[model samples]
Target: MKFLFPIFALCALLSSCQALAGSQAGTEAKFAPETITAFAKNVEKYAAAQGAGAFIIGRIGRPQQELPKGIRFTHTAIAVYSAITLKDGSTVNGYAIHNLYQETGKPDVSALVVDYPVDFFWGVHELSAGIIIPTPELQQRIIAAISSGKNKAVHNPAYSVIASPYNNELQNCTEHTLNIINASIYQTTDMRQLKANARAHFKGQRVRSSRFKLMLGSLFMDDVTTRDHDGKVVTTTFSTIGRYLQQNGLVKHMAVFNRDGSSGELL
Candidate 1:
């Protein structure tokens, strides 16, 4: 909510913000067509193994400079493995992945959108992915909440590639997924409840950026001001959400899918 345009202008006099945005435009992952097809097939195998339900699938893809150190997986999405009916009395069955998508040309704006397994893996920079299959009881609640549009309500459109786990003023992809997951489990989407639940369930580390990095962030990113980050640190990431789910007994098992025709527990 705080603006550092004065400092931004001062810094821009030395460097261009447009250049900074351009340099950080590393969200879209570029994988080969064959790799994408294999990835989708593998994802389907794992989803079907869950036996007709919903689960959370995390992907390790492209990285951005804004993300902190040692964070491998960069994105998380909810995949519903169920048969859906259409108005024409037709039935569709497959993994329907839902996640926040940052629109083109909108800069820091994003919204929740659905993507199929193949569509989800398209442009993913990496071929490895982590699949977290929830227990049967939890899967039903998760699928219902997401299907009813209650999950998207917890998302904040003001996207930040490095969003904090403590606040809802802004959100990143992983942070948005964490909120929706928490809301579904806790049965509430209220802001205060989400913040409280995050404080309790979410756990991870954030690397405090150096003074120079902080200065760069303040100058380039509107949501990355000094007051908001204190030191331009980021805690809400894919690993954090995974840890929360594992600790809370929501997950049945976790498997890492590789492009080399192999899969195993994340460990």
Candidate 2:
């Protein structure tokens, strides 16, 4: 009977979602495409209304009931204001999401993808959105960093759902987002120094550990690994990134938005 809980936990981890970093293949959309498009449009509009040229975005990729303890959003990435080209070859100004998406059918590998908000939220289970807007100066810096191609240079395609922020051994979407943030701040694309800065100031979320859970994780090391941490399993998360920017006085707003366009505290 005691083993049942661990089995369920393992199922949750191996199911449609991969931690709070990115979504896996075979996930279904709870909302219809039109509904998703509307909600995504509103999210993009909200960020622009806040004067956010660049911001961090998170989504609830998995069912809330299946999420692990202390994990809220399931996928996170960066959104930048840009002129987006449509299928008709006409361009419109809006926010474009930059994602480190786990390759379809290959959960262990990821790729940097530039998509719009509708594409970002297309597979979400819920209509909720998490947003972290950096201060104006920081926003400009982030935009500049991405513009200079530093964001792409810092991306490590080796994907782990619970990747460590203090090292570049493996990376997920959230860790990648944090890496780009630090790159923008330090004004350098030096991966080693960026990792050093993260080690100095970042506080990653510690995955609640147990002997049985650790055993299960080991069996699926391709998806979740703790070799990066000598102690507890400390992995970068959306909340950790929010806390880092909030504490450093680089955040203009940290908030959550519902489908109804209501606003609330994120963390």
Candidate 3:
């Protein structure tokens, strides 16, 4: 297990999605359940106050030090404000996170999961959150994409931690989020054209791990791979996505929502 540290570390830094490589990566919770629940509610309240209908939410699924130079979040998902029915049959307004989670045992595959904020932060490494509130038009577009089932059309079950955003050869959480947004904007499920648009306008975060370490990680973890990427490992990250939306005037606001009730600039 000691020798596997380097392999896991490489995966953690290069991965744009959740920490799914090591045994405890996705299962361990840094804060108590009650504390996480309170923090999750706080994030939800903050987004609601901003009038965010649909926004991007990011979480740190691994220790901060394990993250690389340009990466801040280990996982990202789309959160939509909607009415949720409780176990007791009562309904209330809350945010529902749409995520691409690696199957519990099958790390190479993923599934679309709709969960609440508390569940979203239950297995996190930190209480902080990355939020990107899309503009009113884009928010409606995103909600439409999800409701029309276009989101599932763009999902690739063959998961990769460092999937290229410019192509659909493989898919990760961030890429899926981008795909859904593009589907909404372009009003099409054409993956090829969506990817082309991304290549033209979006600049992905370059992965800085060495090839030797990358290869080592691929040898051990099913979700770790750089094969789809040719030379430089450029994949969509939460920050890059925020910048893309901001530059295109599709974002209403973006910020880092911390547990201490303070906010910081996202870009």
Ranking by lDDT: 3, 2, 1
Per-residue accuracy of model 2 over 1-267 as CA lDDT, tens digit each:
998997788876555234454544335677888899899999988998999999999988877876767778888889999998999999999998888888876777888889888888888888999999999999999999898888899999888787778889888888999989999999988999999998899988877766456557658756666666667778778888999999999999989989999999998
Name the lDDT value of residue 240 in candidate 3: 91
Candidate 2 stretches greater than 4 Å from native: 1-21, 24-27
What lDDT does candidate 3 reach at residue 260? 96
Better of 2 and 3 by TM-score: 2
Candidate lDDT values, in order: 0.67, 0.84, 0.84
Locate the minimum summed-lDDT window of 10 residues in model 2: 16-25
lDDT of 2 at 193: 97
Per-residue lDDT of model 1, residues 1-267, tens digit only: 247876665564323222222212235548776768777987788668756387777665544343345565666778887675667999987788888766676657777777777777776656777787777877888888888888778888886666677788777677777777877788998988888777766775574455565566666566343343544465565566666778888888777778875888764
In terms of TM-score, how similar is model 3 to the real structure? Answer: 0.91
CA RMSD of all predictions: 6.2, 2.3, 3.3
Query: Per-residue CA lDDT of candidate 3, range 1-267, in tens?
Result: 799987677656445233423211246677888899899999999999999999999987777776766888878899999999999999999999999887888888888989888888887878889999999999999999999899999999888888889888888888889899889888999988998999899989998777777777787778878889888988888999999988899999899999899999998
C-alpha TM-scores of all predictions: 0.80, 0.92, 0.91
